[model samples]
Target: MKLQDQPPLHLTYGLSIHPDETWPELWASIQEKALAVRARVAPGKAFGLGLRLRDAVSREMAEGGNLRRFRQFLDENGLYIFTLNGFPYGRFHGGRVKEQVYAPDWRTEARLDYTRRLADLLAVLLPDGVAGSISTVPGSFKPWIHGASDVERITDQLARAVAHLAGLKEKTGREIHLGLEPEPGCLFETPDELIRFMQEWMWPRGRVRVARELGCSLAAAEQKVRLHLGVCLDTCHVAVCFEDPEEALRQYQAAGLRISKIQLSAALEADAVGRAALARFIEPVYLHQVVADLGGGRLRSWLDLPEALAALGSLPEARAVRVHFHIPLHFEGGGGLRSTTFALRPSFFRALQNGATEHLEIETYSFDALPGGASRDVVESVAGEYRWVLQRLVRAN
Candidate 1:
């Protein structure tokens, strides 16, 4: 069978690796990194980019003539955008992004506005007859929500966002879905948490609210909610949470939740004996949430690598520690650290075989933070990641 005859999947590398907050800087990064990577990896094929736009850049691009120029640039470069990384609303690098990454969570109008803008931008940028996806933060950081009222507010905000997406679809005829990404230490971190949020809060109340807003029946409204709101399965995050990707994908499918995009990435895994070696990853720029799988199906979680290291004495003995570090997808074993790359293959293959998701984005956003990553050629590393993932997908088919 020919490669094109196999399952159709859109493969791209997330542009979040480039920390360009403005349009000029962003375009430069794309020219320097994205184009270079595409040239080396994809060559003649029309490459897709998982664009990551900050709030400022989004606004600027939305201005008169800017987005058009960008589209022209993509056309000239043989590049197209099918997915966006809207998870971070602001600065993601060169500073302490830690927990502040989830600042304007789904509970606020700001989050809604930002996402709506993204949808609008995507509607224009998305190629004709191609669907687009925007991956966002999962509600809020778990620690920030005080009680049921906070959760209620989040659901209300999400309902509004869904209504906005429905309107976008009505206006542009482009079906862009919001993928609520579940990360470690976030509100809906675990698979169970995500499932519960959709079933309990989103479905029960969201359906009615959406029904009222869209002037549709409850069943139709529920369908809209399901179509608009879905999961962005980040392999690094899921692996860090000790989730068996196959089982998690099955659970999402069984629950009727769409996997909008699968972020092809890897997490750092270290056994108890190799725990000391993980200290190198305890940086201050990003929050490296760690989960240690304790016996009897219990897991001990920490907010960051430091907290995990500090509580090492108090926590019970664990099998392995999965750190929420976006390592290079191409390289698996190095520096006494093993990658969760192994988990990605089975999950990715199964998802593709089962028609789970069409968008597959290589999202190694922490390239700057990785060891030796600073000195390495960013284009080469990203291109290598694209090559690695594409090879796997081809082999799987």
Candidate 2:
């Protein structure tokens, strides 16, 4: 399994990890793992980097003269900055290694402030030699204002963030697009809401026909906005919303929206008895519904993960999708643990074997919060899990 043998479309696979462990130690392990992945499948296409939302060290590295070190690290390791995941944005102050930084109080002002800092940071972090770039999430800004006026306010704030990112792109001499992700409980939850907001509030002057009809643009009606705004496209978010993924993706395409990033996660759907039983152990967020072959007697994890992906691959102009994998964890004795709690099923492996996809990312970031989750062993555990996933994918391919 070398790079040349893989499908032409399967080049952008990758993963994400917190920068809590020492960078030298983490980089060493990551480089070795990525190189092994490259050697095994699609030799030269090293898994890109997903700078998690809570990596203050990486964020700091994105600033000051240290950015040279960071850039050198990417070059040396064959990785690129994909997206800065704004995690733990809610008010949960305690739980895992990330909870402390997960500022749910992240209002629009706080997010704007973070974005400003991030833009400046990227000015140094991602210049030439970088593959692609993305902006941080927009802080909730205003949760109470959910109707038209709230949408309008969010639009203005988002526009400002995009313009700022555009300026960062100009300074860096690279096109770093900022994607506004709609979380499950956030203001911009539905795809329709995000699309509408982008049209009226973000780019009122209108690039699409829908925008032109609304007469929305305020400052520069004739100016053509590049529409750097788009959706993050998380599978879990879509699944939780109970939207038909294939249909949702089509609507997004029809609206002329770009899927800036794709979060690939599995939603565990249980059968009648199992659903009722599992409901007793975990909350609904951790539980979802799925179909089962009464004859086969197996569980259905992803209602349409494969179907959604196959549909995506069929689209000629769809945005590049980045896989975001989340491993399950159990809390015991006031701690956490991450192992083979959830592994990629055979059906998904079969989908990959049939060449039904492009990218694969290892995203088990909450590992540090698992029961007995000591930071000392997290990277090793996560790196091992990464190796396991790669081996399975290669074997299936």
Best by TM-score: 1
For model 1, state the Cα shift of residue 212 in Å. Answer: 2.2
Q: How good is model 2 by TM-score?
A: 0.60
For residue 45, model 2's alpha carbon misses the true position, in angstroms, by 5.2
Task: Give per-residue lDDT, candidate 2, residue 118.
Answer: 56
Candidate 1, 315-366: lDDT as tens digits: 6478788899999988767555798988866446756655678788888888
Give the per-residue Cα lDDT of candidate 1 at 315.
64
lDDT of 2 by residue, 1-397 (tens): 1223344222232233343334454455456645564455444654455544334444555556677876777777666554455543332113332212324323357665565555565555543444233434433523345566555555555555556655555566655555665544455656887777666655653333323433545343223244455666654455545454545565676777655554544333332332222222222111122222323333222222343333433443422221112333221111121122233344555554443322333444433333344444554554454556456557765
Question: Whole-model lDDT, candidate 2?
Answer: 0.45
Which stretch of 10 consecutive residues in model 1 shows the poorest summed lDDT?
A: 1-10
Runs in model 2 lying further than 4 Å from the true structure: 1-45, 53-55, 62-64, 87-107, 123-131, 135-149, 205-226, 276-362, 367-397
Q: Which candidate comes out best when scored by lDDT?
A: 1
Per-candidate TM-score against the hidden true structure: 0.96, 0.60
